[model samples]
Target: MRRLLAGLISLFCFTSSTYAAEVSVALAANFSAPMQKIAAAFEQDTGHKAVLSTGATGKFYAQIRHGAPFQLLLAADQTTPERLEREGLAVAGTRFTYAIGQLVLWSTEPGLVDAEGAVLRSERFTRIALADPKLAPYGAAALETLDKLGLRQQLQSKFVQGENIAQTYQFVASGNAPLGFVALSQVFADGRIREGSAWIVPAELHSPLLQDAVILKAGADNPAALALADYLRGEKARSIMQSYGYGF
Candidate 1:
């Protein structure tokens, strides 16, 4: 009886492992932190793994166009996914908004940035970091904010551009630049700033950041990919996103 029970347990373990799936995902740089947690939870709950690669959405779009093998895309803006649908690179009707992101002007040093963000006019810092506007939605929003404040041209000379929002945050965190515009999720958690000082850029200052996710054509028949899409829309995933300061 003991030998028979051991055989049955081993067979069940093998069967479960055989059915577990892994889906490759392309994630926006800004959503990396929360997505990591979501991916873990997804595997635990569904017995499927999510393999994540994070980067600028625009770059991912170009890569997808050029035949990158990603099965899913979580973009920083809605337009990219919409475009993919138009271009027939993504599966039709699989797109949906997962989060609305906020932007912030942040510095590693405390008290350098005022509540009203008046530090932009003071010329106190020699350099400021931002992502490439052409490649990153957060970078474009940063430019829009400066333009709204009528400081774009004046601040352009002090600009240090990063490849993506993650790099932008790293610039401020490492003191390569005293401060920079970054995704609020990078510096915020649990309804407050996690570290350093930040002035949350108001939504009215720039266009709304409607982030969306979609399954790619390559994943149209992939069960794991489809499952992950459904998972992102579930309450558990939204709670994780909320903790990271993302809006539904």
Candidate 2:
């Protein structure tokens, strides 16, 4: 009886492992930190693994268009996912807003940026890092904020563009640029700034950054991909997103 029971248990374990699915996900650069935690929880709870690829949203969109074989997409802006849905690249009626991101002007040095963001007018710094406007929504928002402050043309010569928001954060954090526009989540932790100084850019300065997610057509028959999409909308994932300073 003991030997028979051991054989049954081993067969069950082997079957479960063999059937577990792995979903490929294309993620936005700004969502990296929180997605890591969420993906881990997903695997633990559902036994489905998520493989992530992070980069600028625009670049991801281009890759998806060129047959990138990704099963899911988490974009930095709503427009990209909406376009994919309209273009039939994504599954119909599966797109939804996952988070709203806040922009911040940050510097590695303490006291470099004030609450009012007066440092922009002072011209005390030589280089200001921003993501490439054409490829990153955060970079476009940075430009809009500068234009609102009437400093776009004046700061143009000093601007340094990065490939994505992650790279933009690295530029400032590494002191390559004294200051840069980045997602607040990148520098925030446990309800406060992680390090350095930051000026929280008011939402009125730019259009709302409503991030959206969608399951791709390639994942239409993938149960794991569908499960991941549903999991992202559940309370556990929502709590994790909130911890990262993302808004609903």
Candidate 3:
């Protein structure tokens, strides 16, 4: 009886392993938290694993152009995916908007940033952190907001640029900068800003941040890649995104 049970268990494990595969994905830094959670859930539900690499969309674009083995891309803006598709680096008709991101004016120090975002006008802080606008959608949005407020020229001198939004958040969190702009998803948790003070930058201040996802040509024949792409559009993934303050 013991031998029979052992045999059955081994067979089950073999079958599961035979059907499982890994999908390599390049993800936007701002979506790291939710995507991690979603990847775990996706693996649990589908028996496939997601191998994630997070960074600025522009960097990922450059890497993809250089033949990076990443099978999928979750970008910070629709333009990158669209451009990839146009360049024939990704599969056509597979691109879709996965989320709409929001920007925040954040400070690790409580009450340092007001709800109206009037802190940008103050000269109290010596340095302000933001991602490089050329590489990050969040950074571009930050510039647009500053421009609309007519503070771009005045505040440009205090800028401390990060390579990506994740690093930009780190700069402020580590006290390198007293305050700066970041993605709402970074500081958001439990239906509110997790710590410190933040003003959710109104969407009207800049162009809409439509984050898109696509399957790269390298993944065109990969079943795991297709599964992951479809899984991202499913209910479980949508719920995870919503928890992170992402919009559909």
Candidate 4:
């Protein structure tokens, strides 16, 4: 009789309190698609709301540095979280690599980006798009990759910069540019390429992109915040990231 009573009480408490716990997360744009899927899965399994906000990691870092009321941060580069930890902006020892992103040269037009390394040499197209290196890690990689291939000098005049990765992808997706560099996750899915053609730039061309996440200091004591940090590294979350083409 006592066991039955305890079980009934536990159920009532869970049902009554679930609506009150909500976790607020600041997410990087490159991981937005996968994060959405993780949030949905988390809520379904835990009954804790995952409120995700997406933007460029660099911009988001600025916001958090300026004391934004965010509880969690998922950065596109590991350095951001390391700085946050050292500066006391985020909880120490909570940082870890959440994903490693791949940079791709993509074009909305079919065959616009030839994988044979001929497009850079052809000089037929006048415009190329990339995220601003100052605000995006992938953008920095893009620039470096071009330089490695000895095309930066030749391509400088035709470069179009986007403020963030999403905007960079949009520049090509919207037909604003013939080709562009963007996160592979944005252009590929389900073990196959998307509508457009792309070349997944090898990691040797640029620095490794090690995305990381940390809990903000202001959120250290909040249960929701703690849960969110934990959730990002969980098995279910990792699986979603893989679907978006991000690796550990």
Superposition error at 228 for model 1 (Å) = 1.0
Which regions in candidate 2 have their CA more than 4 angstroms from the true location?
Answer: 1-6
Candidate 2 lDDT tens digits, 149-236: 9999999999999999999999999999999999998998899889889999999999999999999999998888999999999999
Off by over 4 Å in 4: 1-15, 18-20
Q: How close is candidate 3 to the true structure, as a TM-score?
A: 0.96
Computed on alpha carbons, the lDDT of every model, listed in order, comes to 0.95, 0.94, 0.95, 0.86
Worst lDDT run of 10 residues, candidate 1, spans: 188-197
lDDT of candidate 3 at residue 238, scale 0 to 100: 94
Give a tens-digit lDDT track for model 4, residues 1-248.
99999999999898769544777788888888888888888878766777888878889889988988888888889888899899999999888888899999888777877786578778668899999888899899999999999989989999999988999989998889988899988987898677878888989999999898898887787777777678878888988888889899
Q: After TM-score superposition, what is the CA distance of residue 134 in candidate 2 from its true location, in Å? A: 0.8
Model 4 clash pairs? none
lDDT tens digits, residue span 1-248, model 1: 99999999999999888878889999999999999999999999999999999999999999999999999999999999999999999999999999999999999888998888999999789999999999999999999999999999999999999999999999999999999999989998778888778898999999999999999999998889999999999999999999989998
The alpha-carbon deviation from the true structure for residue 73 of candidate 4, after best TM-score superposition, in angstroms, is 0.8
Task: Give me the overall lDDT of model 3.
Answer: 0.95
Clash pairs for candidate 2: none
Q: How well does model 1 score by local distance difference test?
A: 0.95
Residue 136's lDDT within candidate 1 is: 98
